[model samples]
Target: MTTRVATETFPMPDGSLGARLTMTAGRANSLEPGLLGDLASALDEAEAQDTSAILICGGRNFSSGGDVRAFHRASLDGEAVAYANAVVPRLQAIVGRLIAMPRLVVVAARGAVTGGSAGLLFAADLAVLAPDAFVQPYYAKVGFAPDGGWTALLPERIGAGRTLEWLQSDRRLDASALCDAGLATAVSDTPEMTAARLAAEGEIGTRLATKALVWDEARRARINARLEAETAAFLERIVQPDTALGMSRFIERIGS
Candidate 1:
């Protein structure tokens, strides 16, 4: 229950330890620069620890994605492009690290996990969701290019065609749909506990090796390259004439 780096150690079934990184950004965890920095630090600590797994969960709504309202404001001020440049790289880097981490990475999310934040679920070795939770991509809705592996890594879970279809329209994938699409390991009311329990299973060495084999060096390289492409796309799209209007409309629609 510690908030400092949000690293709470859990004893695993095979007598090893695990680290849980809790997202405590209250009321729809918005991915601000500071929050992203904190998440990067937590991942830093988790990577350095001698643990078998990392469980990422918590926050009222696991995350409402990026601070779109703030992004909208910055757009009006002509700083949206710069803001996207600063934030997209850091967020994508975190996703890269999750994919390359030497141990298991597990995510348990509730409520809204949208935009680039959904990459956490995509990059995880296992992801559990609360039944009522949903995953969405608002890029088309907000006229932003996809970031956070919505293109690069998500296709690895649900395929490219589905990823394209989902992004081009207004739709949210509920937990059951996510599980069916192979984007989630399971759905549960107690997603945090479910994820922690799954993370605690299996031997540490075996789990680590399994993760490495699946997320091998070549695959990691490809993902990183795609993430860079996503970053570039996001920066370009955020500064376009359509983005300000899109953001304003979406912001008013969501009442965020």
Candidate 2:
């Protein structure tokens, strides 16, 4: 997995900067540890540059969720407990950085955004999905609970009842539907254009100042506490017999 940060400068005299970071993988840029480290480095640079806004997306699918192959390996190797301890907490911390970033964070999703990717979408201040893009919480289908702050963030965008239904089922939602549900700000023809539009809509000075204030107040300590709880619950689901059963059933259903 590789995380490449691209900096595109607009003619904004307002001193606000914007960047787009693409987390890429060899095949499916599943959320591997090295990928996460690369992302953290990119975020550090973005923060240092004092970017007014940041966009997170992928080359193809925003992510196929976590590397299923990695999960499968970990389970078979009996490393689930150790892997969960090391990875889940780091994931939660990275997500914390995202949520607490001073500027508005936009997710430009172009394809099927599932699993942990879905959780990252929830961390966004705004999300722009391609018209044909699909998004869903696919954890339960894979025999796991929600992670990537989905439990904490989903209900904030969609109603609690709806969030529950989505989490419990294997339904897929298109970009337009996500926009209608307030999970996404709009649907774009392309992720690049979406990033450009968001950049154009802002004056650097004002965007930066406003974003800082928003992050400060909006991300109270309670939010972090909730995020930690969410991660813990998600990890617990990994070893549950029901989760294993659900995963097997899902795999068979999908003919995978």
In model 2, state the lDDT of residue 233: 86
Name model 2 segments beyond 4 Å from true.
1-13, 204-219, 249-256
Worst 10 residues of 1 by lDDT: 1-10
Residue range 1-256, candidate 2, lDDT tens digits:
4244344434334556677787776545667776766777888888888776787878667777766556656766777767666566666777777777776677888887887667778778778888768987777667776777776766666768998888787689898888788888887788667666776575656765775665565564656787789777867887777866676676567564
lDDT per residue, candidate 1, 1-256, as tens digits?
Answer: 3342366888888887789998887547777787788889887777677777899986658887888888888888889878887788999999999989888999998888988889888999999999788988988888889989998898877788988899988589999999998888999989999999888776778888988998899998988999999999988888888988898889889784
Per-prediction TM-score to the true structure, in the order listed:
0.95, 0.87
Q: Please give the clash total of every predicted structure, in order.
A: 0, 0
Clashes of 1: 0
Each prediction's Cα RMSD? 1.9, 2.6
In candidate 1, stretches whose alpha carbon ends up further than 4 angstroms from where it belongs are: 1-5
